[model samples]
Target: MGWFFAFFFLSGFCSILYELVWLRLTMAQFGVTTALTSIVLSMFMTGLGLGSWGAGVLTRRYGQRVGFPSLRLYALAEFLIGCSSLAVPAELAWGHRLLQSMTAQNAYSSGSYYLASGLLVAIILLPWCTCMGATFPLAMAAIRSRQRLESKRSFSFLYLANVIGAVAGAIAPLFLIELYGFSGTMRVGTVCNVIIAVSAFALTLGGRASARSSAPVLTPGERRAVTAQPKVLLVLLFMTGLVTMGMEVIWIRLFTPYAGPVVYSFAFILISYLAATFVGSFVYRRFNTGGEVDPYLSWVLLAFLGLLSLLTSDPRFPLNTPLRVLLGVGPFAGWIGYLTPMLVDRWAAGDPDRAGRAYAVNVLGCILGPLLSGFVLLPLVGERAAMLLFVVPWMGMAFLPSRRQEALPGTRMGTRIAAYASVVAALALFFTTKNFETLFPDREVLRDSTATVIATGNGMHKRLLTNGIGITQLTPITKMMAHLTLASLPQPPRNALVICFGMGTTYKSVMSWGIPATVVELIPSVPRLFTFYHPDGATLLASPLSHLVIDDGRRYMERMPEKYDAIIIDPPPPVRAAGSSLLYSKEFYAVAKERLQPGGILAQWLPFGDEAVQSSVARALEQSFTYVRVFRPVEENGWHFLASMQPITERSADDLVRRMPAEAVSDMMAWGPAATPTEQFDRMMRTDLTTQKLINRSPDTPPLQDDRPVNEYDMLRHWTHYVHSGMRNWKPDQYGAGSNPPPAGESAQKGNE
Candidate 1:
């Protein structure tokens, strides 16, 4: 039993690792967007469901002798998973580089890129994902065959072990990712696979040692015999699996939009699910074991929980944290605890020989839940509302005839009424708590007639968490220095581009200057509903001067045809989004340079008070552009960068301000270095350093484009900077003991504001 659980847990881990990295690799390699990634995952999930069902059929016909051969099958599957993963990165890199070398003059032919990438994904992932889907159910059958139990115990124990394994799998990846990069993780997974196969094979050998037949357990005759089933039990299990699978998939998908970029919401969701499953098994054992009550009611309750949990979709959903926690831990445990044991017992039929079939069916049910959700439900209503619709299954579950009613010695109307009232009360609270408006301040309360509320976090205490990284606090008066800096730039710079539209501050700033600007933001919600919180948000969203493009900035620039006079990369630092690091990469700068007209400037905000980070980033940027110049708005704070395609001739601070557009010039003279009377302003530009050559060379570093990719040096750069910043109270404006002092310049002050 212990060995079975161990192998099962390890198998779960391998499956998740394979699934996660496979999707990430596909996206990076082939540019498979979120929508397509969802499809691929759904397909794998569907396969698992089918595999589970198939395993059951295979087990019953073959008798209890299938476990020994199943171990070998498990080993082979692991080998396939490991080998495929190792081979993929190399293949993709080779193909991509080969294409680049061939198309030196033209970048890449779109047809060739898609063809090679698609072929690569199919070759590497399709078979592996399929194999992963097939493993769990078959393995469950093997374990169950070894553990002879009563009908109910058969299914219950199998699910219990599988969930335990899932818990183990869910926790290992975090440490694994840190210990080994993606490729290393795959290798480790391969090793884990080998271990599981060995253990399972040993178990099979032991189980068979005392038996009659030793050759692969399931013979041709036995395979044919497994077809007979209790139709009622199979139907019930299938429906239960299908509904649960669909709900899980839908819930997981829906989380992508609301879950912050860095939070690893899917992993969190999976972990919670496994945890819940484990808890549910224990809870079920304690409360409902020994056939005390009909298992159907418990399942119905769980199905209901899965269905009604969709109310957490609102952006203003106040209890996102608690809701997410529940989403993770609740339904999975509830369903398993209340529903799965009954299915197990039914299949086991008070016999240990049939335990494998029961376990296989339970696993099949789990896979089916996600498969149906992704392929059938998600496509129909989209991820969000589809989750809400899961309620239909729950409500339907409630209609199932309770065996308790038929078998109970006595039933009182008063007791039934009291139970009904309690259930209603619990459900009412669930609905009310989940509703966004009920949890957070209403739009009307936040509407300030005096000052246009620029942007408020959607929920009470709702911090703007992008990709799981927190960006800003949700206080009424959020800091506007960053936005104001962009806004205060000179008016009508001919053409301008801004990336990262937090609160639409940069957009408003550009509009104020009357510059025709394009904003590229990856999140869909930002541009669509920016004005809902702030009047300026609407104006910016509605601006004719503003063109909004939903894309990664690096991607947008690589394909952009027109050149801009000023490109403002107001990326929310590496703090908010890991993807932001790509913006700071040398390849990114190269793309930025291509989009700039001659003498045009690219202004980037680098949060580097630390000299090392500043130096490394400066070195990386210096590799791409020319005339890298930095300006400090005040002593020990506010570092702004202005880089150009052409050299920027040295000029007095006042003269430079005067040459700029009126708004920018006014800003420079006012709240800028000129405005801060107590602080000193300075210029930091390395004249001798060649910025262009710093980024472009290196046979090892791949040239970044819309298709080709680059290493994530920016994450390291940010970490390095953060470490140094913590050590030193590093201020951008103030020069240090060893640092160069501010450039000497006496300029005529203009009270432009």
Candidate 2:
């Protein structure tokens, strides 16, 4: 019995570890878009739901009639789970190769590619995910036979262990990935599964002769006597599952902007959710009443969650304090988490078949929730409102009439009227609420699966906002990215790749060169907003030599077959943004280096504000290339890293002007500090930084990687420095900027005005 408890704990731990690593792997293979994330989550839940249902049917029909012990079946399921762990990573790699090959066939459509990839992901995850579901039923059967406790009570013990293990799962990656990387961590999970399988088999060996013979434990009359209206209970549980899972998606979107879109943000949300759930389930076990809950109290609690969620998710509210961590996200997670496992625990009544049956229905609800939240709700209403509106289902579920209603719901005229009034008041307050969205007017809003893009400005200038955080505005410094890289290359560039397409500034400048240029952008809405900022954006996009593709920057480089003379990347601001480290990782630089032609120049934009991040990125770039040089693009806090295999030499603006093509020279002068190459060259000469010295600035600082993203997960270390010292920004004072000072420039700042 003790061994079985340990096995369940280990199973829960490995389950979460696999989920985190698999999601990372999938994102690396496919672009990180809303549609892709939703598809992956839905497929995972669907496998679990089906597995639960199939196991229940088989247990009731065959195992009940023979001398089969459920412990043996449980052992078999654990072994199968272990077996699938070995195949998951291999299958993902093969899928990437297959998808890349099929992309070459012009006869196949992009839709077909997406469909095939999704199907492949589903096939890879199904076996392992299904076996995960079967463990619950099989374990319950063994517990019920060996122990003399109520079947309902045993479920709570196992659930508590599982949720506790999940807390470890959410947190282990921060350290594990830093030590082992993604592949090594997956291997660790595989070993844990083997231990779980072995423990289960050992238990089976001891009980081989003592296995329960096939016999109907509970007659129909007995089952009906225990509970009434099974279908209604199932429906209520389904709605419970739906609201809880859907709200997670909505809350993640709501908080990303404030949380800097880092891995810690997602990890914090999930950890708090599971931690709260563990507490909720533990409380349920202590307060067990052996009866259906009073339906009147349930409705009131559900209604309360609806109202509280509004305050919790609103940005205008003062939720930035440290306590905001608990106050902001815990309300909805606590209430919903408490009610779900208890509902399943109560409905199944200690019977393994009935337990599996009810839990399967709940898992199916989880399958659809993320899909609807990501695709339909977020795109239509935005994150805050979408989060508030989804609570309507819980309200409906609570209002549902129970067979035996306690507390006299809808009994007295005044009570019923007052209840209805309160519900209306909550909805009205949420609807007319003055959040950041409702308070600000006259802003252009665009929504898609990836993000909510808001455009705002005054008079002649404009700014782009993604999920309420300022991404960037129209700026001339962006032009330096295009012209400087082209002019500095040993040979005149024939073609280029721009990783981020912001306001079409870089792309437009690249297009002016009259060479083939492909711009890869992650957010679909970002590219669509191009024309609003640049009137000539449509014209430039129509050029035969220009192309815009929506893709993840790293994945694009990996799957790309062609080489380019120059590859320039301008990632979105606040380097710590979730998944942003992928663009700065040493592994990514290696891939980009391999894709660059001989004498090719790869330019990376590093935004200053965090020295820790700067040190990590600089180290990654220095490690990847043989020769590297850094230059401050303007007087601002950002630097451009120029790297290549070939030796790089400095040249004056006059020297560049003498070699520049007539049209190329015109493009260079169109948007920078200088009207001629000589003027631009003078400003660049003042700000050149030695790459090796910068790498040594923070010695032994770890470089960012896919698994251990130093930038994404190290907020605590960085914030500690921010709290005590008066430093809000990482100043460049340590390394002097001016060798030969250029006079104050106003053309760029004036245009920004």
Candidate 3:
């Protein structure tokens, strides 16, 4: 029993580690759209369901006839999962090359592209994930062969150990990824799987040739009676899987405003869910009586607890970020943990074949949950309404006849009263609470498959928010992103491209030059709200010179054939936002370099970051391009990095002004502290800082790359810094005691407006 517990604990850790690394690797190969993410996850779950059912059928047919050791089969499954750490990455890279080749010959439409990539991902991941699913049923069969009494509750025992390992996996892997890269982290997972495989094989060395079965083969009539009783229990298992996974997607969108969209925030949510689940499973194991809790009462409690998220997420509620997540998601997740394994135990009754089929049914529901939430529910109904829809199913199920024995006398009356009160409370929460978007007085809210976009505020203060996180506000710094890069070109610009269309200021400024300007935005709803920011937005969008592309900026550059004289990228704020590293990585720079005309400059906007992030980004650009320059916009406090293959020759403010057309010059001064183009450029020139100065700030930091997102995972470094130098005394922008100041007369204020 101890050996089985240890084996499952290690196996669970490897599972989560593979999931985190594989998801990131796929995003780098395929485009980083919501649809692509859903495809990857669904394919993974599909493989799990197929593997569980297949392993069960094989075991039930051959275990008694062949006299084979089930531990050997369990060991083989672990060995294959370990080997996937190497095979999966190589397969994904090959798929990427294949797609690129096919698109190069004949461009595929968006729907066709997803279909092609999804098939490729399914082929690459299914076989490996199938092996992962086989571990559970194979281990359960091994337990049944050796210890007959323990086999009756084997699923719950293994589930308790697996979930404990999952909680550790959620928190510990971030540090592993920080110290080693994604590939290196996968190597660590491979080692753990190998250890589990070798240990399991060792346990089989002294086993008997003919294993004793747990229960006698059932008669035909008894088999039918056993199967008939568990039909309702399997339905409950499927519903639990669907609602549990579906709400996880909604929780991320609803809590991003408070959590700030960092990797730690995601970890916090996962840890809260798994840790609470561990407590629930532990309680069930320790306190189980002969009579189980009534299924009807459990359903009623789940519905009531599920609605608590509305109260916790309301704008008027005054709770901290972590507390809000724990309170909102913890109770519901813990209840699910208690119900799932209990239902499986009741259905299987020590039979591995029945347990396998029941678990597979639940996994099938898990496959569709995220897809339904992301593509259908979120896009059509928004977050608050979507949450209510998930709760409705549980409320409906509470009225169904209970399959378990009737409760003792007097308990039925109390149960009905509790159910009525809970249903009333859930309805009250639905009508009373205000969603995050409704809290804004003047706002136009739009929902798409990608995100919930909000355009709010009055004139000159208009802002764009994606999923409740404030993305950008109206500002002159956006105008400078276009003008400064174009004017720095050695030759007159013929065309330009802008990635990330926030408030449409940069795109509008680029169009003032009368050159063809293309803007690529990830969210479809964001471009529709462009008219809310500028009165002339519709007029500009209608022009032949303006082109709007709805796609990921990095992926757009990879597939498109067009080259631009100037390419400007303004990533969303907070510098450490999850996936923001994709825009700043060296791999993205290499792709941008291939799409630039001669002397074309790439302007990267850094809203705000600490010295470590600044140095890592600077080092990546320095390695990718021959020449790089850094400038601080007069209207904003962050740096603007300009990189090009050809040297950017020095020019005075007057010379820069002479190069721009009359319309471009007029647009540059429209929202400026300087009344003239020359004065605006001169003010920008005064704040010029060297790229080397930034690199010197954090000499030991490595360049940012797709495999190593230093910005997203920095907790260890921050903790070490805090220990050596008190965090209260160290400010993020301060250069410490001896570091040189920014160019003379430059303001030291640290964030974008």
**Scored by CA lDDT, what does every candidate get?**
0.50, 0.70, 0.82
lDDT of 1 by residue, 1-753 (tens): 566566666767677776766565555434433333544465455545454445455545553562346555655655665576677567656754554444444444344544544554555455556566556545544444444342225446555666776676666655554335567667877887777766656655666422233333344653344334344555555566666666665554445444433324456666776677678776766666663335334433453465445555544555565475575447645665555666555454433344444544544665556655655654454543555465455444444355534432223555444444434543563455432222334332121111111123454333333322334332211112222233323432676788776555455555556668798876554555465534566666676787887655655564446678778876653322323445665656876887887777777765332333344456656667766865542322334566776765664444433444555433333323334311212232222234333333333333332222122222343344458776364233122111221222212121000
Q: Model 3's lDDT to the true fold?
A: 0.82
Better of 2 and 3 by lDDT: 3
State which candidate, 1 or 3, has the greater TM-score.
3
Indicate which candidate wins on lDDT: 3
Across residues 1-753, which tens digit of lDDT does each residue of candidate 3 receive?
898899888888888888888988888888788888888888788888888888888778876544556788899999999999899999999998898788777756677777888899999999999998888888888887775577767888888898888888887788998999899999988999999988888777756313555344445664675676636678777988898888899988888777767778888888898888888887777776332534466787788888788888887998988888999989998988888887777777656788789889999889878888888999999888888898887776546455342421223767767776887888788789877888788999999888899999887777888887777777777888999999999988999999999889999999999999999998999989989998899999999999998888887877777899999999976677778889999988988998899999999998657778889999999999999999887665678999999999888999989988899888888877687788898888877778789999899999999989988788788788778889775454232111222322235463421
Candidate 2 similarity to native, TM-score: 0.87
- TM-score list, all predictions: 0.65, 0.87, 0.94
RMSD of each: 9.5, 5.2, 3.8
lDDT per residue for candidate 2 within 19-58, as digits (tens), equals 8888777776665656666677877787778777877776
After superposition, which runs of candidate 1 have C-alpha atoms over 4 Å from their true positions? 30-37, 50-68, 91-124, 140-159, 198-261, 264-269, 282-294, 303-328, 341-389, 399-419, 434-495, 508-516, 530-546, 557-567, 572-652, 663-753
TM-score of 3: 0.94
